[model samples]
Target: MRALTPALAVFALAAVASCSGAPDEDIPRRICGTKISPEITRPLIGRTGAFNEYSRLDNKSAQTAPCDLLLDEKPVMSFRFAWSSDQVDPMKYADAESTDSVSNLIEPRRTRDRYKSVVGDDGAMATVACEKAGESHFTLTMKLPDATKPDTQLRGDIEKFMTAYMNATVKEFGCRSR
Candidate 1:
């Protein structure tokens, strides 16, 4: 069996450490900010309607949100890498692109041609996937709760979180598809 490397281990540690909260409060943050679709859930639930973090790995009853402000909750990171050449599911790609019911909790506004991002009353992020295929690779990024604006630094955290999940997906290719 191949052995572990020190550099690989340190990188893992750093990724987990930054997963929660902004590195610094002053820096702009892009959390699964209260993207709660207003249509579903009780209205006037308060701007601080309180958010919950459920594990993509497992479901649990619930608990106090790790962050008091909804903007502080880190979205569960996930990705789909199109790598296999022979036979892959077109429906799978289609589902994410044309028919993903990530959450039917909100009405969609015309955001762009590629996809419509339906923001819930709480501001949780989901996507109507658009595939820009590369020769042998395409990446699907679920950047839930992305910061609303284009603060360049905020995008860094987005890339960091996405890269970590994508790399994990590439490594754990045998796990069940979501």
Candidate 2:
């Protein structure tokens, strides 16, 4: 038994190391018809389980579009894009809908002047001016139903992820607001 101890230890260490590495295979490179960076989205979606994406964006000119990310068949994140005739306050919207599990919405200081955005532990929201399709602005709201990260770290990641997602969605849907 003593002779096999070292071999067992090595096996255990290898297994742990492999498990701790990045979960590239589990995360999708694209979501909701938009290509995404796995590194930017991993913290929100986690590193395990089967992943799937469902999107309701058939109408490019539609006022609202929704997408969902699932882990092991359970919803992990949800995204909604809405075009409104008037500007919507992201902070107020997030605050009214926030639950006990989520932190208060905070405006990101680094956000560009073109966008109004808020970040929280469980979600993020951003709105950009848009004139196309008769919409005054485009709003993107993301909800992380299964997020487990701390407030500070999660908010940072949410900002980055939300920015990328919102930009990509606008371009892909040809709603650049010319």
Candidate 3:
């Protein structure tokens, strides 16, 4: 009846407004400790190793696990993503402490930590770290392929690869992308 019509209309309008857009509550939220899916690591494998060679350090029991990439059945690179309320903020840590004095000429501006490099007679190693939503932080460490230390070009490529991978992983995992 006409008396009930007005009340129904108000309720219907409120319902529609509530669901109109993807409010913050509707957006996917990643818990700080959600497990990294295989889909995330798949693209980063590249030619370094077969996807089958990947393994979680804790047997995937924990949401965030250290992982390794193996090539020719040898460990090529190892990385992990961890977020903790008690842990120092990665951005602040980078600013305060100089973990590695290696120059950060090729480091991406968006990253919270400067790219660190170590080149030795054996090979080269690089580390990239970033934070998301001021809550989730990730670090990726890679062992460069060549036996000799990587030159400038190799270093640049490593920076690019790690930056791309970090961005993609953040976006894929429902975190704020850099």
Candidate 4:
């Protein structure tokens, strides 16, 4: 029994030693590094849903990964980084909406926030041009909530919020404005 006791002790020690440096369980949920903060989203969208990562398919059959902030299970806001190789011109987006009803009404104009409300759509949109890490024309869009009856003052307020939100994103991501 004494001889067996030494073997058992060795076995116990070996078992513990083998498992001591075992890898930890993999955690699946990771926050998308888009710098969408609660301070910017809560006032506009009430409470934000979980951080989501998704890919958008561009016209050239390429994918652009974006960090999304969802509200009521819909992605009302998103941020993405891209290179100039994609040949995406953020300013040209306004031209595409020229046929919309609101396009004739308000005309998609560039202000501090670059907001363009769709004539017949439910919400407003803003796009900011960013230069990320020396790559020019990197852009991000802040999709504001839909206003049932958006007046001039309400649109002004939305633009202010969108500008502040874009500024916060710029500061957080260390990107220069283009």
Order of all candidates by TM-score, from best down to worst? 2, 4, 3, 1
**Worst lDDT 10-window in candidate 4:** 22-31
Give the count of colliding residue pairs in each prediction: 13, 0, 0, 1
Report the lDDT tens digits of candidate 4 across residue range 1-178. Answer: 8999999999999988555432122111222343334443333443333434454523232234455545445665444534453434343543445543211223344554342222212223344455564454444444443434455534554455556555554466665665
Candidate 2 clashes between residue pairs 3 or more apart in a chain or in different chains: none
Distance from true location, Cα of 166 in model 4, Å: 1.8
Ranked by lDDT from best down, the candidates are: 2, 4, 3, 1
Model 1 misplaced regions, further than 4 Å: 1-52, 55-139, 175-178
Q: How many clashes does the backbone of model 1 have?
A: 13
- What is candidate 1's lDDT per residue for 1-178, written digit by digit as tens? 1356777788898887555433343232322232222322111121232344443221121111232223236343222223322333332333333464432222222222222222222122223222222122222334333334333334334333333333343334322222
- Cα lDDT, model 3, residue 96: 18
Cα TM-score of candidate 4: 0.47
Candidate 4 regions off by >4 Å? 1-40, 46-63, 78-82, 85-91, 95-107, 113-134, 176-178
Pairs that collide, model 4 = 102-119
Candidate with best TM-score: 2
Q: Rate the local accuracy (lDDT) of all candidates.
A: 0.31, 0.74, 0.40, 0.43
Write model 3 residue lDDT over 1-178, tens digit each, in one string: 9999999999999998655433333222221223333333322232332322354543122144555455566655445554432333333232213464222222322332343433322222333333444543444334433323335434444445455455554455564323
Residue 103 of candidate 3: its Cα lDDT?
Answer: 24
